[model samples]
Target: MVNIQKLRFFDCNCSVGRVAYPHLSDIPDVEGLLKEMGRAGIEEAMVYHTVARYGHPPAGNALLTEAIKNNPRLHPVWVLLPHHTGEMPHPGRLLPEMEKHHVGAARLYPGANYHNFSLSEWCSGELLGALEEAHIPLIVDMDTVSWEDVYKILDNHKQLPVITATCTYRNNRYIYPLLEKYDNLFVELSRFMGAGTIEDMVERFGSHHLLFGTNMPQYTGTAAVSLLTYSAIDRTAKQAIAGENLGNLLKEAWK
Candidate 1:
């Protein structure tokens, strides 16, 4: 058995600050978040702010930058929106700010509950096109958007690295086809709890596209860590899913 500690975990799905409905394990500050990461043996995390999701993107994105200013381990994943309404920056300006802040990844909340926006080519083509051009990794939750929309985004932006997180377990039907189709598409591994699911994915889709993510605050890292630790795959595959895959994605972004 490989020691869990040896796997350098880099969480792709995590958030900080108090939300409207706070989770029982929610950590509202960076100190507590860092401590939790240490407890779970997580070396780094791509974190966003609650305000960014539920509140305005500009203010929330700025708050995220300030909150995680000096912490290299806690990478900021800024919440972005359509540039049509002037609520957020256009691609030309947004890329520079991302570079300045050293943001590792970007996310979109194009749902009724959060930012109400369209993900179609006509609506988000400019922004999505820029992200693809820059090689920035875009993270989207499956619950927030329909599978059809996900397909459209992938089909349109072929080279854009997109990570789909927080999908329900029934997602195999919808997700499997996507994994098979899009080389730029990836899935976050926190919720794939079916026995031998990870092993099957590694065998079929290759381990490079499956990322390790702990839906922190709402969940703990222990289960996620164990999921990869005890998976019926080789050590090299486990390590790649744990952090290397995400690290490579971040490295490819225009820093």
Candidate 2:
């Protein structure tokens, strides 16, 4: 009954600006992003903060949260720094706040922000535990870490479903085994290389585990949208990648 082909998108890996590279840190504003999404057929997007690029995770998350609060089409995803500040925000405190404010997911940028790969005892146990208990999906920037490191983190927390992002064309091969190995791992097709790459990933991994994403300002939304529009896959699979997969995931998380 869900019209997968006509379904809009919920981009899982977008960021707002930070102070680091003022010019380069320019992510599109919510209105601008919504307009772009409309043109590209995206209905909503789950975005996070880019302030980590400037070493200010809390501020960045605050900006993102406020932006999404004002836009019905935008959903906020808080960014947490378990390694940078040497203090993890209390998940018991934070998860309720996110729920109170309508935030849907938590994102980690380990490679971009230089966080330790191991999710062992030293990591932010409280935060991770709360997310698992709350059943909120965690989005990780796979572009920031190696496949080996990603696997290790996934192994530590098998219950949490992680949506991986900032994926480039070259990492397609590395992503396959992980997709096959973990039922909870999903890949966002953001910076994916070409049409061929998208088709191959969907063919091998099926459409259920691939979500549509556009890094936006860093890359054109149109280009990322076109990659899927032009792919040879069935309309159902394309629909799943575009938004259905992310929607189903959110429905389960919010349930």
Candidate with the greatest lDDT versus the true structure: 1
- Candidate 2's C-alpha runs over 4 A off are 1-7, 22-28, 83-88, 112-118
Q: How does each model score on lDDT?
A: 0.88, 0.72
For residues 1-255, could you state the per-residue lDDT of candidate 2 as single tens digits?
Answer: 785445466777666553345435354577666666777776677877666434556777777777667677778887776633545446666677778877788876556345544455465555666677677888877656667766765666677787778877778677888887888788888777754877777777788988889876555577778778878998888888888888888877755
Enumerate residue pairs that collide in model 1: none
lDDT of 1: 0.88
TM-score of 2: 0.85
Candidate 1 off by > 4 Å: 1-5
| Count of residue pairs whose backbone atoms collide, per candidate | 0, 0
How do the residues 168-227 of candidate 1 rate in per-residue lDDT, one tens digit apiece? 566888888988899998899888787778888899988999999988866788889988
Model 1 alpha-carbon miss at residue 246, Å? 0.3
List TM-score per model, in order. Answer: 0.96, 0.85
